[model samples]
Target: MAEETKVATGYDTKVEGEIKTDAWTTDGEIVEIIAQDPVTAESEYTEMEYRRLRWKIDLWLLPLMWFCYGTQQADKTSVSVQAVFGISQDTHLVGQQFSWLTTIFYLSYLVSEAPANYLMQKFNMGRFLGICMLFWGVVVLCIGFAKNWATLMALRALQGMFECTISPAFLMITGSWYTSREHTLRSIIWGTSNAGMSVITGLINYAVGQHAERHPGGLAPWKGISFFLGGLTIFLAVLAFCILGTPRDVRWLSDREKRMAVARTMANQTGSDRYKRSEWKWNQVITAFKDPQTYFFFFTTVANSIPNGGVTTFGNLVYESFGFTSLETLLKGTVPQNAVSIIWFLFVGIVTLKKPNLRFTFMVVSLLPAFTGMLALALLPKSGLLWARWGLYLMTVTGNLPGLMIWTMLPSNVAGRTKKSVTATVLFIAYCTGNACGAQVFQAKDAPRYIPGLIACAILFGVEAAMMVLWRAYYLIQNKRRAKKIAELGMSEEESRRQGLLNAEDDMTDFENIHFVYKV
Candidate 1:
């Protein structure tokens, strides 16, 4: 093992060793644990012990987050399934009304994101998220009984308000528990749950549709879909409330394990202030907006999500337009498209893990298949390409990759609790905006082929791909400037690492923390 590099100052002492024991001063749990026995804190936990703690965390935490996120995605996307099974006709939806169903959901999502994140910061994140899930599940259940488009709109709005907390909460939690590389890997695991639930929902929709076809008189397939998903969501909400929380709150981890958990995360340089539910900083909020990467995240998210919104909302419709029945569309089109997405996500996760710093490069690479697919859908002969057009549609699922990569960037690149919170809120606003606008692109007037929407999505995909390169360049430049500044200060590598660990405990922003390195 490398020799322990113990750095002592007037304030506190930290050891940069095989098992990091740097405590975030503001995190009472970690500070208390370290203060109880400084000698043991510095010497405790071997590499094997660290790996075992990580495994325990993974065993308990990953599944809850994975399913909660998946449940949210499935609940939201149920509207798309409903659209095909007569929710539109029964609810008297006409022209753009069907599109407005999706638009309003996101509009509500856009408005509620900031407040939801605020509540998360002020309360127990796990409990706040669970309650949000519970209420959204109720809202989803209420949607089953809606008799008109207006009623569905109201329920969808409530659902949006309740469901907006999951992403930001998960991002903050992942950042608190894991180091930079582990954050990327775990983010991908849960992020891919969106597609994973897509597959599950496709199968469920197929079964529900099939059941409806046979009965011909019982519960409407769409309503049945909502009822089942809503119930599943409530069940997951209970799990989230009981099991999902930060290292400080979870009862599953013993005291030693909790200290080790926080210790392991010091390498990230991002503060643990989120776990404390600390006070907000307006300056950090302003810094989040001022950061160039903030706008890059915004523009890139909007560009990528525009196509995502259109494709997801109109996916089954697009498949049906390609000469298949609703059941066939669910089975062959939705399942396979999402299956391709799962494959892409796993492939991206493995590559990023094995070959670090390739995220932006893969971001560009991932968009190519989607861009090419959109171009084909726009320019190719609309009539009778049959399976060829379907293949192109499947390629569009890769568009989800850029969005996933963007989330990974947040935990690894952004620092400071309030800054991370504000940035996540802004990022989701872009997400909601793009999705709302995206739903409108696939107008009834552009049905069957939706050539204009296809063309617009193609253009947006190109814009997103170019933005990925620019964003990567910005991160690289920022990292270089910070590295040069640290070198000029005559800080040795060990000193630089020590300073970063110390800065993280003070809840410093990435800009204020000179030793904070931006991960590309």
Candidate 2:
């Protein structure tokens, strides 16, 4: 009892119950928020209260995240849709010049990731990312005016640099707000916006393409796509800057609501760093580099993203090869394929949300469909299997789902602010590297069939599947090792819970916090 009390009272308390850290007087902001009324901080709220709070968070945060991500995705992949509508010809792109556009975008994205992640850790994530989106919107709008491939490449590079902050920032934001159980579903909801926006963007692009074809005097169809997407992105940026920030910074929530929000996520064991404010820990960053799971995440992202990069850039072309006209490809190929992706992600997300432990299992299972789809594309007779090929193309989109699952693991399993930032940096560097490499694989010489690219994609998905199995095993082993240590300590359930709550506020890395349990 004495030890538990000591643990609970690690920080000094004022008359008003404000927590004061020893090393830094004003740190542990979440703890301080809840500590204003220590008794309520220790007490459990009703299920109704938690549900109501979650509903409020969902209402305020998710839709904005969804819209923002959707706009980002549409802007990023606009070139793919534009290629079919005559951007390639208008810009005088030669062999592999088109592929280089995607490559340069990711190369810039790769170079910018480390610094972008550093800024995310040091600032208000929502505001920082909103500014980034705003700049990228301007770049995308400028892409509409480029008259040559060189100008397009320069604009793509700038877009990549500006947009590199989105994924890591979103990951951190999601982790700060949600519990491990809620992470999968919420991550999927926002993450699936890529596919969701595709459906929406695909319809708009098709309509614009039709109008451009009819009116000789109007702006080019490809340019129209960029103009519309860029404007939409700028509009969303205004909302994001105002409405979407960390719970600690948002204006809509009262102090009581903020405390409840922090208190509710205590079981996550991943400490909140939102209000900690610019405290960069070099040791945690070092530990992130040393951790074995970091490598797994890096390798898995590379493997999974190879297929993603190839297909994303060349999806419309692949569809065109399937006996469809330019406009028909948008309706038949891009729209339907992304529509399938939306359903697949939702089904996987719901199942994993209910059965949290099955995350890697679903990841591995998701790859199989895409693996089979790519194999069909690589080996089957291209002339006769039009509808069958279309269905298989749809299956390939499921491969992207596992990438979302990998991201969920970062916030739930990793602890410490700098460690999470470092891990995200490594993961995204791999993401950019893999996507850049994948872009080059679909060479112009192999156009229409692109057998080599299909074969490579199929092979990479298999590698991703194997990596998933290994990653799951590694997590299970780590969890069992931690559980054994906790068992040896002979702590009661109540004591363990207390210890976990204490650790949750400590900002300790997962390796340093013995009470930290891996969410396998």
Candidate 3:
């Protein structure tokens, strides 16, 4: 006897999607799902609707990630505050060596970034990064125990090696979990977390410095700050272990939700389920290096990081010049971050909608304000108006300019997981390039008037803007060529739709043999 078909609950083809087939749904109903075989129990995977993601997955996940990476960024940069409260006196720290303590992290990070990302491809991402988090937390705690410059520098290097993977790891996780619409907002949330860290750094400095003065025979407040933060980071790392960083790894998701999620991503990457369980390959690594988008993001980050280096490392000094007391200077410095972070984030989202292709334009335009502000500082004689410097501080939010497009653009064009990982790794290397050079600019003697350094940053940012323009044009041309090729082939409309512009097959064709194309 033919049994009555079971209706699949919560498996609306509009939302969960189906394979286009007359097959038994999860509840055993025979329907034309978007799956491959009409008679089998296969899933009909389709793209995820960006307008329909539940808040639990996208919203909650973003904040937790923001907190994790923000803490890391802020705590690592807090050494500037330590340098202020006589940490140099305590350790007899000096030039270059003092600089190395901060800069060496970038070296370790660059060295570790590619391999760490490679590992994420092979291992369970949450546990892998969570373990790295715990290791770095220990190193940060050990910073409190440093008795000399040598010890502090060593720990910073170790900290860098461990943290190398944190940002890229989070980005990779976010890319894997969220749809294209959610990625921009999530990236901003993650970027904004760094702003949160800046705010905390100022507060921590005040709190720790107070402890050192009032409490006797205890660890210095900065030391206490380092240890406390390290402890906090470890606790958060534990929380990370509980969450599946990748959607594919999440057991909590039902087969219905899993199919919906998988369908959305696979549609973007390739047109089938071939990649559902594929492992790493050597060609995947080489493919990432070959991508042009990888290099565009790289140049943009390098440009952006130079400014980040100067502003972040020497923001304290900029405040000090305005003649505030030590704590007051930090307090004042913290004030700008509150405004700049909000501005950077909201500006990116709001402006992107108006001019989707205008990201690079805005990035280049953003540098002008700070550059002009520096000119104002240099040319305008020092008067009672420290207002210009305060404005200059606000203007440095130019660091966010290229960033608006960096992560978003990668996912927009690339679909393969390996390619995304490779793009992120290369992008961060550019980020580290800027950070490494920027760290060197805050030389001890250059304080109060780091004019030379600021001027150099302005020049580099200009160079980045130029590169961005060229890169944007280059991609546009590549896209047009691909489009023309598709039309010249005289393929049917459906065939053209299926194969895209260049007929480039996404790396995962083993599961379902089909031709695909890169979209312009």
**Predicted structure with the largest lDDT when compared to the true one:** 2
Error of 1 at 17 (Å): 23
CA RMSD per model (angstroms) = 4.4, 4.0, 7.3
Every candidate's lDDT:
0.83, 0.83, 0.64
lDDT tens readout by residue for model 1, 1-520: 3556554322244665553334433235444445432233434679999989999989998988888898899898888888889999888888999888889999999999999888888887888888889999998988999999889989988998888889888988898888888777788899888888878877988889999999999889999999989999999998999888788777787777878887677678786532374688998888887788889888899998888899879988988888988888888898888788888888888877877688888888888988899888888875898899889888888888889889888888888888888889989999999999999999999898899998899899899988888888888888788778777667798787766766666676776676777777
TM-score of each: 0.93, 0.93, 0.83
Candidate 3, 200-293: lDDT as tens digits: 6567768887777887677777687787789988987887766746665554555555555544554343322223334666665676666676
For candidate 3, give the lDDT of residue 438: 85
**How do the candidates rank by lDDT, highest first?**
2, 1, 3
At residue 472, give the lDDT of candidate 1. 87
How do the residues 446-495 of candidate 2 rate in per-residue lDDT, one tens digit apiece?
Answer: 98989999999999999999988988888788878766766676766666
| Top candidate (TM-score) | 2
